[model samples]
Target: MKDDDKAVYLGTDCGATTSKVGAVWGDGTVVSTKLLQRVTRSQDGPAAVVASWVDAASDFLSQHDLTWDQVHGAGLAIPGPYQRYGVLDKSPNLPDTFTGFDVHNAYAGALADRAGRPIPLVVGNDGNLGGVGEAQHVRGRGHGTVLLLAPGSGLGCAFVDERGLPLDGDTLAGMEGGHVPIPLHLLGAKPYPCGCGRTWGCVEVYTTLSGLPYLLEERLEKYPDHELAKSGKPMKERAFALRTLAQNGDPLALEIFDFQAKALGIHVAVMAMAVDPRYVVIGGGLMDPEATSDAFRERYLGVVRDTALPLLWPAQRTTLTIVPASLGDLSQSIGAALVALYRSRS
Candidate 1:
């Protein structure tokens, strides 16, 4: 493992349905043009899923004429919380088999076995990794604390502290901000069930990709003759298209996003009041240029700012910068890789 030898490490972002394998330099340069992807096969069980990802990563490296031993370090970004580095604590989104599945040493040992030697490969929750990746990305480095709001399948909130490390440590290990409670009235939302089994008040219930479906049902009840209800489209599909429809001036879509953005903005305010991070990074499919139109992005962000600004302290209200996430979908993957590299050096 020469720091100057230009070794390529691997980073894997494991999602519920798929896993992406990427090649990266220790300096954080992604070597693979297209990320190598594979179905997660979570239904096969945790052990099988873990081994498959490792094998897939191994093969991805081989395509670059590299092997595990030639790698500097590797990192895995898992979707759920865990402790002792790799053991899974809970996984509501994954199959029931994943609960309490101890990954403590088996995962690291398996990597060592594959490389035929001890190399630095680590695993961490995806939320924490997203903050880490942005902290190390060229555009985001040296920016002091970063508060990241990731609003995709679920709402993910993470922090990279002023020290250029994830905010997680022993006392706050496995912290997940998505489940933090927010006022439901922010969206005129009722106590809808969250994926975490909470009946109400979770920030995720109103501000994520999954949350839209619930919002749709509630919103449509009042507008029974609304175009969305009459279209006969699947709830999920309709919810996903909310941004597009809003951009095209669909009144119902605009109203729903207005509520969603306002709720999300309030969530951000509450978190910012606690962390006081210098940068607030908002990202995910809802606002990605590739996923939604700029018209929609502007409207959503404007609503967020309007809803949040007055809630902040006067000083932070002026100094805090809110910007879109720079790394987009690649944040967690690259962050995991950075985690490996940073931990190895530390």
Candidate 2:
């Protein structure tokens, strides 16, 4: 699709941190240059989140002198795990009212009010949409299994089949990759307790922003004389300082950061081995280049390169490339737009 010839669809990625919007045309031209900080899922209700989206859309259209009718369709991507037909099953990061909420109907109502008719609305999991966008846009029409990992409040994984089709449709078995058990035996460390209330250990329990503090605090005995505890500050600030120190090659800080990197790398390696993806696209809060350094990046990639399986296990040989998400945080919006475009065609 060419930029001018493509359908003009609107997409909103309603993230816990921010909402990103974009316009995709039929001619393959994408103009994604706007963002709104999240105001939903606070002490307020889930309806507040839907209302905020409408308000943001109105503001965006007003600024550009674009009418609601100009939008061919609208897509909204929310964090998962989604229930049957685009309902949120349980979004731990959001308000409790959002659990099992009818996201599609909520969005349709909002758009109908603004446009005088319900603009076609499609909803999807943010990670799923992001992977779809990356595979379609950035990867340029290749055919192979691919994995998209977004390490934010929790670690999320989205896998696309070799045919370039995502596996969320009815009748397909669910793919909750993050909830899969982590092999702590490989790391020689005590298994970290998971929020899932399972002591068996899941990958997200140790790899996410929520998990970072616990990992660092557990290792605090090694750095009691370090600045974080000594200053009576919070763990996150200390983690940042430790990250800086690691960047500067301080021994203790380097050790802690390496543990995190290694843990993440191990999960990636396991995912790659399981899916045999040709490429792995990484995004989310932790993927911010500011939070990690090139050396740390290499440490994460190294685990994939050095990973080995048991002799009896069929060792899969495949070339896997690791790269940053092309859209960064904007992926969900772009993906949502893509989904709307797909639905409109159907």
Candidate 3:
């Protein structure tokens, strides 16, 4: 292939437990992809983790019968509280070793050294990139502004404008939607401690899997005959088991999902009021069909539509469309690649 036609970009999506690496063409077609588990061990330190990322990227190119010279640039999507420069201020899910680590420079330096040339790179929050990916998917389909919610080890949020570009600008400023506080009255009597070390309730604590244990305990107390409670499994195991039961039509499991859906709906409503987005895309394993079933999507959207309608007040609730992510779990990786393609061309 000619150099111009063969040109590709590298992208990485770094999560709490795993990292996804991929290479893609400028047209959004993925050339290669891989998942690296436990890539961010605290003992390994930030530099080591960053090295692993570079290794992954190089491996991806080799697997595709390409060379670093064909790579135009690289982009990264990471769980954050990070600056635009890719310096992690602090990550609740990441090891303490990553605090204040300049991940961008580390990856850029390592990759550049391997390629024997300078490489341009960009970094963004994983959730924000997911939003960008989804927004790009539906850009011309009548969706202008897009809001994305990622419920997983923690809750994540991001916004995109009419052109499917992130609204946070080059610095990625003001995109920390997960840390948005939830009213105490909205939460149950017990405190919902966030993974961010905050004792107070936040949207993440009540909407994601990590927070489901608290709600499960509340439900078990109310329904002593619940199958999950009878199993006596640990909190994490019980959470997964409950998802299975819910998919099987267990009443208690369904009830727990309803409670979670309500909380998520309320939060979405608040965000919609603020951003007035045309579409709200919910992503993450929690929303996948295998975890809870399509019914979870229906229930969650129903609550969002119903709750947000009155708040919108004469703006016509139909203006908003709440839906699941179109790109599914691959959104972040694709988005990171999109960022690289855009930045490299600029």
Clashes (backbone N, CA, C under 3 Å), per candidate, total: 0, 8, 0
Question: Distance from true position, residue 268, model 2, in Å?
Answer: 2.6
TM for every model, in the order presented, reads 0.89, 0.85, 0.88
| Pairs that clash in candidate 1 | none
Model 2 global lDDT (CA atoms, 0 to 1): 0.68
lDDT of 3 at 104: 83
Cα lDDT listed for each candidate: 0.76, 0.68, 0.75
Q: List ranges where model 2 is wrong by over 4 Å.
A: 1-6, 33-36, 62-65, 162-164, 169-173, 234-253, 290-299, 303-318
Compose the digit string of candidate 1's lDDT tens values, residues 1-346. Answer: 5554677667788877778777568676767646577888989998888798778888887788876666888888886666455777666578878877765366677778888887677777777887776666534446578888888778767888765567766733544788888877656668767787877578887887777888887789877887788878889887877777777888888888888889888988899878887887887767567777878888888988888889889998888878777677777777788778778778
Residues 1-346 of candidate 2 have per-residue lDDT tens digits of 2333534787788777567776676543565555534555445767887888888777767766667767778888777666667688666567678887888898899889988987888887777777777777546756866688777776667777765555664622244566677778776667777655567777776666666667778777887886665767787666656656766777776666566556666777777666677777776754556666777666654543454222112444435666666666767777778778877776
| CA RMSD of all predictions | 2.5, 3.4, 2.8
lDDT of 3 by residue, 151-237 (tens): 877887889876566766555655667777765575454667888888867778777888888888877888787667787678767
| Worst ten in a row by lDDT for model 1 | 134-143
Order by TM-score, highest first? 1, 3, 2
Better of 1 and 3 by TM-score: 1
What TM-score does model 1 achieve against the real structure?
Answer: 0.89
